[model samples]
Target chain A: MLTGWGRTSPTAATLCAVHDEADVVDAVGAATPERGILARGLGRSYGDSAQDAGGIVLDMTTMSGFTRDGSTLRAQAGASLDDVLRAIVPEGYFVPVTPGTRFVTVGGATAADIHGKNHHVEGSFGAHVRRMRVVTGTGEVVECAPGSDAFAATVGGMGLTGVITEAQVDLLPIATSRMRVDTERHADLDALMAAMTQGDHQYRYSVAWVDSLSPAGRGVLTRGDHASLADLPAGTDDPLAYDPRPRLGAPPWMPSGALNRASTRAFNEAWFRRAPRERRGEITSIPAFFHPLDGVRHWNRVYGPRGFLQYQFVVPDDASALVGLALQRLREAGAPSFLTVLKRFGPGHDAPLSFPMQGWTLAADIPARIPALRDVLDALDGEVIAAGGRHYLAKDSRMSAQTLSAGYPQLARWRAMRDALDPRGVFASDQARRLGLTLGSAP
Target chain B: MINAVGQAQSVLVLGGGSEIAGAILRALPAARLQRVVLAGRRSSVMEERAAELRGRGIADVETVDFDARDTASHGAIIDAAFDAGDIDIVLLAFGVLGDQEALESDPAAAVDLVTANYVGAVSVGLHVARRLRQQGHGRLVVLSSVAGDRARRANYIYGSSKAGLDAFAQGLGDALAGSGASVLVVRPGFVRTTMTQGMSEAPFATDADAVAAIVVAALAKGRETVYAPAVLRPVMAAIKALPRGVFRRLPG
Candidate 1:
């Protein structure tokens, strides 16, 4: 049984670990229309994007390696950002873009077209990729680069076009593996949005943690940039030394309601109160500043057996008020959200299915078992779509096909291009089947 | 594909005319369901049922002729349903509810009822299980009556047949444990349907929709077995624990 990060809607798939390009070709070649094939990375997508029921799932993590030539790194698609960072950080380089977690593989990152806190300044991960080698549904290897139709479809195509085997990515140079951070607390959603809209341009990275349970949507905003050697203490040793290890592992089991309203509300309250009202230029480790939750292994388990759903949507700057309205709806529905994040996105790239746009994006984690959560989200989906926004497919586990079509107007063009590349409809995932991304019969 | 939210896209009903199965199909989200396959003996009722599902907004609706007593044809019937596509749910809703007095007086009629309920279910159940196992994921919902819990004197012939079916379904569920395919045995109390139209209302009698709602909820929770009108669970326990002499003395 395989499920995505959300641990929901698990389905059985014949897992085939591909060690090289040949194995990927063999796997794709063996796929039939009845049970199609899908390429799986580290399975970081929160929904069913990585799984295919009664089909072949090519596990691409076994083929992993990378080589750097100056600022450009030619890396295997299966190489994770975590592994990439470990190898390149000491050499004064970092991935151009990373999502909330570093466990995602290059192939998964490109397929999802993930964006990071630096999105307002830099585009999504696809923008940083110079070129890629993909094994199409017909078992043919093709090289695609920027401005190519293949590249546009392959990136954020949700692996429907083909299996990405390798990518040439432009790396970001870093002086040290530390971040120069600035922190501030906002009393309400308006303040946070104003501060982000006005001052986000000055920082390389920015994100806000909002208290969904709070009536005012209180939040803590953090912004940072790579720390130069002069910014670090003179006595610091091995400034580029980078090693991130999980400090704690969640217990084997947690009760279904362990993260209920009472517990999460208190946790959110304490977390909000702990942040400084305003603190500037505090030196911090890259892992600490970027992925604090990564320090806790299997942190998602804390949500319990029913798992959780991450509802993330991007609305244009003109419709940013929907963010506050969503929070208010969640609060009114009595749904307890453990984590809520707000970010600003720069202009989206050429990838038709890519999620990012010049807009305001908000993501929240709510327990899947909550009775009121589905209706609340459905209502939010209508408003979000009406506001000219779309949901992040990487984080979605339950959005409908109508919502997908309404959110992504380019779906028809993407489908046409995808069908051209794979006429047999060999590449399929549960998410693809659920959202009608492919023309094949629903599985 | 059944999504994380428990919305199934495809369903195959083994008994097209079964009221309980129709209720369950209607209770599901019609807009999300892409296909509905009703397998039963050919008749206008089957076509009308298909038309009804299509009218409800289900895009694809098809029917195949299926005879419960034709054990030799069971494999083909199951293959026909699966060959169309991967079925997310299979409703095993075919059975005979013979009149107790007439069945008891005529041994041949009693044997026929047993053949239809027990023997026929075994044939189709095994065939469906094989397909589900090969597919690696699907739910087979077996509609077992609460009478199967114990064979009372009033309707022992029909009750015993259902008892055999319930046991077969339970064992089948165990066999599919780690195969990612499993069975859900739904034991509903006296449900007011065409089959039970003329009978006097049994205590705690429920409607087909109520049983359907319970089954849907149980399937969502991944339950192996459930009693419709859930109160029947405790009530059945008391009935099963009664002394044999007292149980036989109780009115039908």
Candidate 2:
């Protein structure tokens, strides 16, 4: 049995820990006809994309190691972004793209085609892949580079086409591990959106944490760029130091309803108040600047046994107002979303099922213990779909098949390619089955 | 799988026709429970239940034969269930609440009740616990009763059997403390199920749905033990403190 990061929608599968390409192929070959298979990274997908109920799940975390060559790096499917960063940061290099956390594996980033705060400038993780090795449904190992059918299908393919064995990625050059950050507080969503739209181009990374509990959609906005050697104070000897450790961990057990509306609102208010009205060029470590939440282990447990859901969606730039509308709906519904993350996406890649596009994306984490959590999210999904926005598949756990189909118009094409690669549907997952990605339509 | 909101995608009810288990599954948010497996000795009844769930839009509904008396095959049955896919909850609801008078007269009947309710539950509970531990997560729901809280003269045999089951379940839960798996012991006083249809309604008697509601809520809270009709907690407390002579004077 396996579950995604959201800790919801658990499914049972025959978990096989694969140490290398050979093990993955053997596990794939051993899959029964009645049950399909899927590969799992660090189980950070937030949903069921990496799990196949009653099927086979290749635990690829053990199949990890990496080799770097100047600006290019080759890594196993399970090599985490954190692992690569630790190996390369001291050498004055960084991964081309990283999501909110560095705990995600290289293969997962490739499969999800993940994007980071710098997406407005650097594009998604897929854009930096030089080539990759994949174990196909037929148990054949093949190397695919960008522009190839296999490459396109495997990228953002959600692990349906084959088991990603390894990949070569292009790295970004950086002079220091520190990020020169700028922070500002906004009283309304409109002001924050305007600020980001007009000035975000000046920085490499930009994101806003909206106060969803507030009626005005108030927020704290931050923009950052990789610090150069000159940006560091004279006393700083190692600007490239990259050490990340959890400061604390939520206890395993907690009473349900621990994070109610009152507590969440108080937290949001305090967090917003702590941020400076305007600060610039403040040097912060890489983890502090980009993956602050990563410093706390098992933080999801704070939501109690019900855990929490990450509802993320992206709409075209013109429909940016939908973000505020969605936030207002959550506020009106008293959903008590603990956090609201807002980001801008540049042009999306060619992966048919890739989540992002040239748009505005907002992600909210709502504790599932809320009685109306599901209803509120369903309502938000309708509003998002109506606004021509789509939910991020990587973060979705409860969206209906129809909503998924409506969001990703190219799903049919992606399914066609998946079918062509695995005619027997040997590579499938709960998410795939739920959305009917391999079954033609919603089941 | 258990979801972020205490919703499970799949459930396996060992006692497929158990109204309490059925109600528990039904009370859960329909969108969260996509699959259900009703495993019991009665295939036709399980199939009927599965059909009803299927009609309600549950994606997958299956039936498997599970006889509590078949203790030797418990491991295989558990393995088959997990093989079917990750079962989020294993509901141990099978038990024979034999007639106290009949069991008093027939030693064989008394032994049968003990075997099915206590010995059999222990065997299967251990099997399910092993599988859940191997999976590194899941829930084992044992249907105990307030009778287990004390062996009463009205139903001492049944009460004793449940008492044994309850103790064993709690111990198993403790053994699994850090394994990401846990056990839930549900003690419903007098549930109005088909099993207890002809019995007089006891004080604070509740229906299967009511007990099911409490069980769902308790599971969400990650509770180790719960007494249905909640009022029973205070009532049971007072009863447990009564003198032996006074307790014996209570009617069946």
Candidate 3:
């Protein structure tokens, strides 16, 4: 059985770990029309985008390899960002863009075109990609660059165009693995948005964690930049040091309802109160500043047996009111979200289906068993669609096809490119099927 | 493959014209379903049903000749359906609720009911199970009935055949446990299909649509066994626990 991290909807599939492009080609060739194929990397995608039941799921993790020359890095699609970081951090290099979690494979990041806290400054992960080798549906390997249609489609096409094997990406040079950080607390939604909009450009990375359960929308805003050697304390040893490991984890058998409204609200209050009203130049480790959640293993399992939903939607910068209205709606419905993150996006990548745009993206985790969950999300979908905003496909388990099309206006162009590359409809997944992405002619 | 939101990509219904199975097919999220194959004795009538599904937005529909009594050809028919592509689900919806009085009076008729409902079901069920196990993932929905709970004099022949089928399905489910294939045995009491149209309403008689709803829900939950109208579960449990003499005295 293959289930996304959300664990809400599980389906069965024939999972095979492919070691190279030849293995991928053979696997794709062996699949019958009904048993389509999909490429999975690290399984970090929060929804069914990585699962293809009753079909062939090529686990790309086995194809992992990493090589570097100067500042350019060539990593296999299956190599996790963490793997690349460990290899290059000591050499004064880091990935140009890193998501909240470093566990994502290079291929998965390319497929989702993931953005991070520094999206306003560095753009999405795909922006730094120089070239990629993809195994098309026809069992042919093609090297594509930024201007190629296959490159654009496969970048955020969710592996529909083909299987990404490896990519050549530009790396960022850094003096140290530590981050110079600043922290602040906001009492309400208005204050938080005002601070972010007016001053976010001054920092390389900025993100805010909001307490949705609080009517006042109290939150903690954190901003950081890679520390320079001069910024580090004197007599520092191994300033470029990088170690990634989990300090704690939830047991495998946690009971359901552990993240109910009361518990979540309490956790949120404590987290918000702990943040200093104003603090600057705090030297924090790279992981501590970018991926605090990664310190805990299986943190998602904390939501419990029934699993949870991570709803992330983005609207244009001008329509920021919708963000406040959304918080109000969730609060009014008494919907409890365990975690809420707000980030500013600078621009989108060339991939037609790339999620980020020049806007504010809010992501929250709501328990699946909430009584008003479906209805509240459906209403929010309507509002998001009306505001010309779209939900992220990587984090979605349930979004109507209508809403999907409404949000991604470039879908038709993407589909045309996908059809040209995969006319036999060989590359498929549950998400593609759910949103009619494989239909090729859905209105 | 069934999509995350519960839409099956392909379905093969053994008794293509079975009203209950048709209802379940309609209840599926049709937009994501690419193909559906209906196998039944009368290909013409099955073709009509296929057309109805196409009208209902199920993109592709195919009908194959399948006669439950022709056990020799069952393997070929099932293999051909699977050869077409991976089948997400196979509904074993074909069976007969023959006239009890006629079945009892005629030895040949009694043998036919036993063969069609018992021997034929086991033969095709095993064939479908083999294909499902090979594919590594699929669902088999077997329509058993409450008549199998305790044999009744009014329909002993039919009840006995169903009893054998129910046991076969349960055992098949166990066999496919680690193979990623599963079986759902649906025990609906006197579902009002064309087969039971003229019969007097059994105590808790229900229609095909209701049974279809239960089957759909069970498929989603990956349930091993289910009783339609649910109340029949306890009712049948009590009936099975009664003394032989007490069970023999109960009315139809």
Candidate 4:
């Protein structure tokens, strides 16, 4: 049985770990239409996007290997960002974009087109890729560059276009691993939005943690940029040293209702109260600023066996009000969400299926056991569609096919390109079937 | 495939006219169901069941002829259903509950009942298992009865037939262990359906909808065996352990 990070919708697949490009070619060659094939990385995708039911799941983790050439890092698809960071950070380089966690593989990051806190200043992960080697469904290895249609289709195509074996990505040169941070607490959604809009350009990275359960939608805004060596304390030794490991591990099992309304409310309240009202120029490690959640291993288990759904949607800048409306609706519906993050995306890339747009995106984690969750999310889907927004396919497990078509207008075009790349339709996944991504003719 | 919330997109009911099978289909999340195939003997009852599913928002409702007594045709009937689409759930609910006293004297009727209830099931069960294994993922729900737990004097003929079926299903489940296909043997007590309408209510008697609810929950949890109303598991155990002499003396 295989499941995404959400641990929901588990399906059985024939797992074949491919250690090289030849193994990938052989695996793709053996795929049958009755039960197609899909590529799986670190399994960090929150939903079924990484899983194929009754099909061949090519586990690419074993193929992890990379080489550094100046500021360009060429990594195999299976090499995780954690591995990339450890290798590059000490050498004064960092990934151009990273999501909330460093456990994501290079292929997953590119396929999902993950965005980071710096999305307002930088673009998604796909924008940094110079070239990639992909094994098409026909068992042919093709190298695609940025301007090629295959490159656009392969990036954020959810691995449907083909199996990406390796990628050459441009890296960000950094002076030190430490980050110069600024923090502030906003009274309500309006204040938070206003503050972010007015001052986000000054920092390379920006993000806000919202209290969805709070009526005012109060939140904490944090912004930072890579600190220079001179900014470190006078006696600091090995300023570029980077070592990140899980400081703690979540319990193996937790009761289903452990994150109920009352407990989450109290936790959110305490979390809000603990933040300093206004702080600036605070020194923090790279892990502390970007991937704090990674400090605890298997933290998703905190929601217990029922698991949780991370609903993330991005509306155009003009439809920013939908972000506040979503939070208010969840609160009114009595849906308890523990972690809610709000970020601003600069501009989307050429990838048709890429999720990021020049807009505001909010992500909230809601327990699946909540009775009102389905209705609330469905209603939110309607509102998001009306506001010209789309949910992130990487984090989606329950959205409908109609919603996906309405949100991504280029879906038809992407399908056409994908069909040309894999006419036999060997690349398939549970999400592809759920959202009708690999169904029907392109037109 | 079953979705994250445990809703199946398509279901195939071998015994389409069986009230328990209809109830199970109705009990599923209607909004999530795209297709429902009813395979049973051609009759207005099967058509009515198909109409009911269409009314419940299932866009595709198909009915195909299936004859339990004609074991030779089981493979063709099952193949047609699977060929239509990937069936997420297949319900094997066909069986005969014959009158024991009448069957004892009528040799032909006894043989017919055994062939329909046991022999026909084995044939259809194996066919469905093979397809499910080839497809790599699907759940086959076999509706056995509490009578199968042990043979009693009152309905030993029917009980003995179900006993054979129950064992066959259990063995089939073991064979498909790692094949991504599974068998859910549901041992329901007397259910208030057309088949048992006029009969006296047995201990732990349940309605078809109640049996359906139990079966649906068991499917979600991926359990190998389930007893409708749940209490029948312990009751059947005690009844099986009862001394044969004492059991024969108990009031029917």
Residues A22-90 of candidate 3: C-alpha lDDT, one tens digit per residue: 898898777665658999987878888998766889989999998999899998999999889998999
DockQ of 4: 0.42
Better of 1 and 3 by DockQ: 1
- Chain B vs. true chain B: TM-score per candidate: 0.98, 0.97, 0.97, 0.97
TM-score of chain B of 3: 0.97
Please name the candidate that would achieve the greatest TM-score relative to the true structure.
Answer: 1
How do the residues A1-443 of candidate 1 rate in per-residue lDDT, one tens digit apiece?
88888887777889998899999988888888776899999988998999887789888999888899999999888999999999999999999998889999999999999999999999999999999999987899999999988999999998999999999999999999999999999999899999999999999999999999999989999999999999999999998999999899999799889998999889999999899999999999988988888898898898888787899999999999999999999889887886899999999987899999999999998877775666678889999999999999999998889999999998888888888788788898888877877854222
Q: What is the C-alpha lDDT of each candidate?
A: 0.90, 0.85, 0.86, 0.89
DockQ of each: 0.55, 0.18, 0.24, 0.42
Number of clashes in model 1?
1
What TM-score would each prediction reach against the true structure? Answer: 0.95, 0.83, 0.85, 0.94
Arranged by DockQ with the best first, the candidates are 1, 4, 3, 2
Question: DockQ for the candidate 1 complex?
Answer: 0.55
Per-candidate clashes come to 1, 6, 0, 0
After superposing candidate 3 on the true structure, give the runs of residues whose Cα lies further than 4 Å from its correct spot: A20-36, A230-235, A254-258, A303-306, A324-335, A367-382, A400-402, A419-425, A438-443, B5-91, B123-138, B178-180, B189-217, B229-246, B249-252
The alpha-carbon RMSD values of the candidates against the true structure, listed in the order shown, are 2.2, 4.6, 4.2, 2.3
Better candidate by DockQ, 1 or 4: 1
Worst 10 residues of 2 chain A by lDDT: A434-443
How many angstroms is residue A129 displaced in model 4 relative to the true structure, after the best TM-score fit? 0.8
Per-residue lDDT of B171 in model 4: 99
